[model samples]
Target chain A: MEIVKKVVIAGHFGVGKTSLVSRFVHQKFSDQYLTTIGVKIDKKVIELEGATVKMMLWDIAGESSAMKIPKKYLAGAHGLFYVFDLSREETYRNLDTDLFELNKSLNGNPAIVLGNKSDLVEETFIEKLHSSIATDFKITSAKSGENVEEAFLQLAKEML
Target chain B: MNLNEIKFRPLEKKTQVIVFDQKGKVLETDNTLVEVNPEGVNIFEDTILCGMEEQFLSLKKGEQVELDCIHTDFFGKESHYDFVVMRLEEENPSYGLVIYDFGAQYNQLFDLQQERNMAQIQSHRLERENKELVDEKTTIERLYNEMKDDSSSSQYILVKADSLLYNLDFKEILYLEAYGDYIKVHTENKVYVTHNTMKRVEEILPANRFFRVHRSFIVQLSKIENIEQMSLLIRGKDKVIPIGKSYKSILLQKMDQL
Candidate 1:
């Protein structure tokens, strides 16, 4: 028996949280301003662990100030996809808060730290931050389509 | 790190002279007589040899006798000393008794004071060192906790297979390996490669769990099956990772401790 899982994408404002999943499921990129108000959902049926798992991914807005997510949208999430911007320190610092709050909302939910905007930051700076946190993180440029799917795939692989 | 043998030395036999102040309490005990020129009995005489002889002659082995001991000044003043105190009857009392009082025994007081000071200094140094060892132990414990947490917690590494999230424990990861732009994460089960550099990928993995073996490879030390010279053999992959020159010594020392 196989049960479908819900994976939520969460982070600070304008960190391309929505674009990461949209890019993964739709395989498209656009310079568009679609601020996710409450929650937006995407469905991707993929072959995982010798079974067909339909992953209902929730792309939560990446606004740091919007700390509380209403219960209506915060339903039954099994995993988390945390995003952060490389150029913005505020976004990175808020990443902890995002993970913290997301964990509070969905108790014991697994997460993947996604490092967005890898195209701009140098490899040296990224290497320096490598050993900081315990969670796994990956560099992906949403605009460049760089390891975007790998970041999402790691989220599903480690959880399922 | 500079260790100069910390061995203990045995006490040596010595000839002693006990000096007392006006109060009759023994002030200074010196081994000058017992150590050298035992035949010279008069140490406070007109000549240096006589003065040495006088110090020895002033005391008799079994006689509890006090004589008029002369104390002199460096400027050649013939100061008459009242004291030579000896226990003519007792056999080796814990301390030789003061049977006589001589010229001001101020120099005797000064010498004993210096010895006391040296013992205190040695004790103070040991106290500080003990405190530092306690501090070092605390630091080691803190680091150990950090390492344990990193290994046990779930790490979200980017990968090509979406389902790898459930299969691997982040702590089981030994290292990240780089092959050009594609970084392969070699864990217990299988090796997964994604479009990433080891440097960039290292940031995503726990620093303590996955060490950067080379620019092309990062290996989990816990999972290393064997080390053949400069190469490390990971379980799954036929290809071996090289042990870098800079990291070789530290790796060897740590492996030995394990």
Candidate 2:
């Protein structure tokens, strides 16, 4: 039996969710930011611990609040990757509330919070952000392909 | 026209129809645009369809559910579709899936949305840049004010002469004297003449340190040694500056005396 899991990539507008998915799935990165309409699905197969896992990544349209996301798009999701641009403070300033609402829909599904665009920010800024937020997040860069694979694999491992 | 002679036109080529049982097993297909799997065609193969099973199950006979912007790559080509599922009014009560290929329209919308999003991001970036510039300007102005305050006692006035500029220290000046079209700046060591007026020189000097005692003379307060009834003598200088009758009272009020 093939283990297939649906994972959702969600965040505010222009948060690099699409870029992260493209970098991880296709090993391609683009500087152009074209907004996602509705949902775009991409599949990737990865080997972990002697098991093959097929992950269906659903890139949902961006909304300012998690509650504004279409419930259907998040339905039957086994994992979630909540991404935010590190250089934009407004993207994650209300993270506490956004995470609370997103978790309510997940029903205890595994989620990884990612602060993307690490190349645009300084190391001190990343340190300060870690101290200010209550949740733990991994710093990744879709442009530099830093930690992108690890984050997806980590979520896939947790989902399995 | 007779009922037997009447003919109906076929549906558009882009539209595909598939009939499925309640368990999502495809029983019949009238597909022209999409390629069907040789073994089977299951609605469960589409994740979106699986997600919408509840809505499909509750749909009554003759009632249909519509889902827009459904994406599929089943034809070996990426395409967008709008799907309509209707519960058939039959003995077996099967479901009919009508899929319309709307790739052209969806692509148009995608292009428009892409432009709007890019424009918004550009506007946001410009706003951030403008705010940073404003903050930098304010910081520079603050530092300039603080530096000006710190060096208040040792300020220099730039005096232009012939082809050179001179930074005359305020403490070294004895007094300013008007000479026709120019003002002579006398210091402890020398007298430097520049084309200026006493009135303009008074305004440039610090009000607390320099005072206008006469129409032609603006003396440094610290350079005054002795004040007589009609004139004042400069410290360490033999020259005496005449005090104007109209300016005597105010000049006396400005000086410290017992």
Q: lDDT per residue, candidate 1, A19-115, as tens digits?
A: 7777888888776645554345556777777876667776764455436654433445678777887766656765566677777766776777788
Query: TM-score: which candidate is best?
Result: 2
Cα deviation of B212, candidate 1, in Å:
61
**Share of native interface contacts present in candidate 1:** 0.00
Candidate 2 regions with alpha-carbon error over 4 angstroms? B1-13, B19-25, B40-67, B83-98, B154-258
B-chain TM-score for every candidate = 0.38, 0.60
Model 1 Cα lDDT, one tens digit per residue, B1-258: 000110121312221344332223333444332222324332222121111222333445444333332232211333323323343322332123222222245346435544554454346547757877999999999999876686557665446644454345666665676767686666666667667676677676665556666656777777777888788887665767898888777677656554
lDDT of 2 by residue, B1-258 (tens): 111111122544577777777777776665576666525656755434653456677778778877666665645657777777888755676787777788888889989888887777678788889999999999999998777656656788888776568898888889999999899999899788899888888888877778899999999988999999989999999999999999889888888899
> Highest lDDT among the candidates is held by which one?
2
Model 2 chain B: lowest-lDDT 10 consecutive positions: B1-10
lDDT of 2 by residue, A5-118 (tens): 889898888989989999999999999887877777777889887787878888887777898887867767889999998988878978878888888879899999999999
The DockQ leader among the candidates is 2
Per-candidate interface DockQ score:
0.00, 0.41
